[model samples]
Target chain A: MRKLRYRFSSDEALMLAYRDGDSGAFECLYHRHKDALFTFLYRGCGQPNVVEEVAQETWEAVINAASRYTPSAKFRTWLFQIGRRRMADHWRRVPQQESPLQEAAEPVAPATGPGDEDYTAFEQRVLRAVGELPADQRDALLLREQGFSLADISAITGAASETVKSRLRYGRTQLRAQLGDSL
Target chain B: MSRDTRREQGDALPLPEMNSPPQLDEKILAHARARAPQRRVTSRPGWMSGLAAASVVGIAVMITLPGQDGVHDTLPAPHWEARERTPAALSQPEALQADTLTDDVAQDARVDAQNGTQKDAQKGAQKTEGASLSAAPPKAVAAQSSARQSAGGLREEQARPDAQALERKMQAGASAKKIGRASPQPALNAVAPEAEQSAYRTPESSIERDQEDRDGATHQRMIEKGLETCAALLRSDDRPAAISCYAALRKDCGDCTLPPTLDAALEAQASDSVTSP
Candidate 1:
């Protein structure tokens, strides 16, 4: 509820500490990327509920796995990678119905929470357009928008770096088309 | 038109972004903060810097930190700790003999403590003896017999740190000898009844051994060993050795009752063997 009191170094640093039983570091990490991750999931999967479930599950996996994670992998890369695996698992558990984005775009509900109406509005469109994309293209575009390097994106997607670049090239081109006059 | 105009024009479109809901970040971050894992400062030293490096450097750093430092209590490597921590194997007549000898030595030290004359000498002896004798034999024994219960070898192997090597081994010995693979018995009942009660049954603690945990260890070990052997065989092109080795492991464990997931794991192992270079 209150702002967490932690001087975190980086997301990776925070994850390392959190993995070793540092709750505050985890809180700092959550705050740092909560929106980015939620936006990533919300847009990537197109179900606000699934976004919430997967995001929560992702955090749980990170917590449960603090000790087991390898430091050789980038923290974000690992987190998203785990998130994607969980997403796949979730789908496997339940059948793949249409994502909410295709059926209907979820309106950003007013809450006693963070974010200005302006940014939420901008992100929501980015979110829906993203949902309408093919899984690979959607993930590439979303990762790029969230400031992932192509190499990092490639690692997360388990594709070659060049493949990631092509995904981005194709993804951005699609976004440019889909965003239409907005581009 | 550039991204700016495109974004601006897209702003007015029938897209989801056009509707500005209040406080979405607040809602999401609120959940993130509520559910995020706890984070401690990096007293464990330069960890988590591996995101950008290649695999080798990352593995090196991780290995450098191997288990937790003594202060932290997390293990560095499962193999060493696991072997040291199990006690069921100690009942093998050989290991128990070691335990009995240690028990006598412990009694002698207790007697020396009452006399209060050789306290310093006794403490030093106790420390080394404790390291070599107090904790490990029963562990090696228990780990072998208890393998049937814990499912994920990784979980059991990793979870070994939760139990003191001595107590778990003794407990495993007492239980395994009594139950013979029905349900898992606690692994640390070496000390007197009062001490055992105090150690494992503290208030707010439900530390009963998980039924699933035992099965997990064998799975974990099998998978790890299989993967390691597979990788090695691939590099060496030792086809006959690899297949035979895999078959032997499978046959040995075949009649033994296993967790349901094991069938899938074994199948995966066979598939990997087929596909491996």
Candidate 2:
């Protein structure tokens, strides 16, 4: 009954409940956002291992900060903001040997099944194009793809709204140029 | 279409499918569960608070009640001193009361000696004679019997202070006799009839033969007031306060007899205090 009740609760309500010592609320919240957050990190960093590490650290930071949490902003925006900062700190501590775009540019594997061939190939192409864009443009485009408003993207990335708009425009233009006729 | 909307529409493309591993979910959830905040304990148990309140009230009653000096003051100095030296004397309250009456008579003799008033000297001589003949001996014997019946059973230790008080009374009588010798003829005439009449009197009336009956009447009024206070406390259903008031009464007036109902109430309250947690 409690799980069913929490399932329909808003993200902020669930987070407040977790802050007030209901672990079930946190479980409901984690399951709701785990896939989206993992995809965001994986697309940002282009490495499965780094995605898992940064995601775990981000959730750990959330758990440690539950006692002090106030509902000043949406829980989703706060979560993605922490994920973004952890990803940035990881890159700062261990600088990439080469650009993430260069690393993603080498990733074309043929689909195993005929039924998923066309869509899988297209999905990989789009992900690769998104990964190859400059880091700021890619982050803006990805966060925009995750359905954040322009203001939310600006807040998460700590950039001006115009800067975020410019990044999204340039990123889409680059993806269009790279995957020209297919897009 | 607007430029930003066109860009947003153009960027809507298929994304890769991904999810975090089950093992990592288990690990983070375990950490969250482990770090969950515990509810605070905000109140104590009912009995605990009751016990604390009772202890505070008991301490306040002990601090506010009167001391034992009022009853002990009427006793002669030498007798009080000797009783203070003997630890067992404290347990013999009846003997102390008997000693108080005897010492008051002695004090009257001393006052008569200093004043050299023939009337006071005659009264003093009569009281001194009454104490030796009719008042002091019977009360001292009754006090010894009561002391033997008391819980401590210290009759012999109680008798020692009475003997000291009696010797002091003899000294006061000798001084009064010296004053009487100054006007031997008139003093004899004044005391002769009263001495014969005092012999047939009861011990209670004899003990009431103070030269200044006003002092005895005032002491009786104080004892009555104290007992009334004790009775009022019991009527108000404040057992602890009633017990405290009764204890003060006993300390102030050791010989003052309590009515039967108040005595029974005090016993019941004392038993309840002993039996309760």
Best by TM-score: 2
Tell me the docking grade of candidate 1. incorrect
- Tens-digit per-residue lDDT, B1-277, candidate 2: 4434644576565667679999889999999999876544568889998999999999999788735333234333543343333334433444444344333433343333344345356555646643453334655655653442352223223333443443345336533332222211111111122221111111212233343355556656775576678878878998689778877866776554543345763565455431110
- Interface root-mean-square deviation of model 2 in angstroms is 4.2
Model 1 chain B poorest ten-residue lDDT run? B199-208
DockQ of the two-chain complex in candidate 1: 0.09
- Candidate 2 Cα lDDT to native: 0.64
Listed in order, each prediction's TM-score against the native is: 0.37, 0.47
How far residue B243's Cα lies from its native spot in candidate 1, in Å, is 99
Q: lDDT of model 2 at residue B93?
A: 45
Give residue A50's error in model 1 in angstroms: 1.2
DockQ of 2: 0.31
Candidate 1 per-residue C-alpha lDDT over A18-133 given as tens digits, one digit per residue, 9 for 90 to 100? 66665667667766666666666755666766777787778677766766655787788788888877887888888877765664434465322224564454445556676777
